[model samples]
Target: MQAPGGAILEGFIDLLVEDGDGLRVVDYKTDQVALKEVDERFAGYRLQGAAYALLAAGVTGRPVTRVDFVFTDSGEVRSLAGAELAVQVAEIRTRLERAPGEEPSGGGDDQLRLPGLNGS
Candidate 1:
């Protein structure tokens, strides 16, 4: 599903592996990078992965315990699971919810509060 601001909030997954008492969400990455780069962009990609995990969890109801970001550029894949992704999703959701309304924020009738500003 896409959010009001054109952000996609769901996606598909490749595999759901079960490890006896635990589960794992398998993903693929084709990027070439180190863990440092991944750490830097955690917030950038967390939403996308969390969206996928949420959708998957809704369908499975087993709690998506893992999220894998397989970068297709450097063969480096990162994972953010459990509470980490949850926090990211929460942050994103909060930001989205608190975002400005459809109306713009600057330059409006109220902005002309100063006297003699309209060539009067």
Candidate 2:
């Protein structure tokens, strides 16, 4: 997908399921955080989910209503939808537009990096 700054971003989503509402993106994680720690762990995964949501929506031309982050090690499920998802997507787009070091923090994307995602 094309970011706000005209950088192309691409990645594979773990899973996609369509229901009455719309498409849902599910990403499996091994963070090993317990259910009680979900809130903390969930924050770090939001932008990744948002990116998946945007890509899925663009590719299928369907609204992405939800994103699910499943913590395999802890058997926990965290979800992002509605307003929260929108906020994260917007935040990620803002980061995508900025040049590498310009991102305030969590700017290291060693997990999955797109060549021009930092608007190179």
Candidate 3:
């Protein structure tokens, strides 16, 4: 899906539910974050949730107003919406648009683990 800033996004959505006038993205995670750290530890996941929101909105032509991260390990849910959601999505797009030669901030990685990248 093409995001607002022209960033291409693709992912397998765990669940999609209609929420009145908009859609909500729900993702199940096994991360072992404690209940108290649900939101704080969700730092980088904010980008991932934003990506899911952007992808779903672009593909379905519907506003993705919510992204919920369900941490089964702690049985906690971290939710992002409204302004916060928009901010994160824009951040992801900006990251995607960065020049190839520029070094990334915050430990030089976006924290998404992958094969042969970001120390994964």
Candidate 4:
């Protein structure tokens, strides 16, 4: 999928459901956690959810108004919609457009050093 900013996105969505309202993207998570901590534990997955939503919308020609994270371990589902969903998508696009030479923030001694890259 080509993002509005011209970035090419490629991935497979676990599932996409079409209904009366619009497209819904579902990503299954197997993380073991209690229901009460579902939101906190899955917070980092919002970007992935948004990406799936964008991909589904592009493929189906329908607006993706909802993104769901289904946690199989605890049978909990978390959703992002409306303004929050838009924000997450926008953030993901921005990250994708960053200059290639720019290092991500919080760089430290623990930075990963791949073999034969950056003189490693």
Candidate 5:
């Protein structure tokens, strides 16, 4: 997938479900956390969910009405929708568009790193 700024965003989503409401992006998490604290523990995953939602929407040509993080360890699901999901996606996009020579944080094996940025 490609972001609006022409940056390549590639990933494999765990699941993508389509229904009358539109597309739903689902990402599986194996993190072990208490059910009551799942939301707080996995809050950082919102960006990942948002990215999947955007990619799924782009490929399917449908609106992504929901993004879900299914916690396998606790059998809990955290969902983001409406304006919250939109804001997350927008924030992620803004972080992705780095100026020349600017280094992006969270550069790791799992995260997508843009080439030619910060000497990468």
Candidate 6:
């Protein structure tokens, strides 16, 4: 779903848990292989988690400290928590706020100078 402000937030989480520490964003996957890092599936889910965290924080008035992805098929669960998740969310929000032609910090597309196209 798209946020009212126009951010294209995608993916719906399976569950959200909250307690004294903070909110925990949980998403279930039925993949055959388990994921260990921020690959495509993980990246997509991470954004979804961040969006959920934002919504939960607004409602509860407390920061969300965790986001998790559970692969039921493999029975493997991976999680990103605390300040790290917060930082990731912030970084994603920054990317969403960027205007056209504005490159992200640390040079994403600048590294590849397409041989003959730009006289490399």
RMSD of 2: 2.8
What TM-score goes with each of the models? 0.53, 0.80, 0.75, 0.74, 0.80, 0.60
Instruction: Kindly list the per-residue Cα lDDT of model 6 for residues 2-38, writing each as its tens digit.
Output: 3233444343456778756777877777656545532
Best by TM-score: 2
lDDT of each: 0.53, 0.74, 0.70, 0.67, 0.73, 0.57
Candidate 3 off by > 4 Å: 3-7, 100-120
TM-score winner, 2 or 5: 2
lDDT of 3 by residue, 66-96 (tens): 9998889988887999999999878766765
The superposed Cα distance between candidate 4 and the true structure at residue 66, in angstroms, equals 0.4
Query: What 10-residue stretch in candidate 4 is worst by lDDT?
Result: 108-117
**Scored by Cα lDDT, where does model 4 land?**
0.67
Return the lDDT, model 6, position 62.
80
Of candidates 6 and 2, the better by lDDT? 2
| Best-matching candidate per lDDT | 2
User: Residue 61 CA error for candidate 6 (Å)?
Assistant: 3.4
lDDT ranking from best candidate downward: 2, 5, 3, 4, 6, 1
Give candidates' CA RMSD values in order: 12.7, 2.8, 4.2, 6.4, 3.0, 9.4
lDDT of 1 at 13: 65
Error at 78, model 5, angstroms: 0.4
Q: Runs in model 1 with CA error above 4 Å? A: 1-9, 19-22, 31-36, 72-75, 92-120
Alpha carbon lDDT at 27, candidate 4: 75
Off by over 4 Å in 6: 1-11, 34-45, 100-120
Off by over 4 Å in 2: 99-111, 118-120
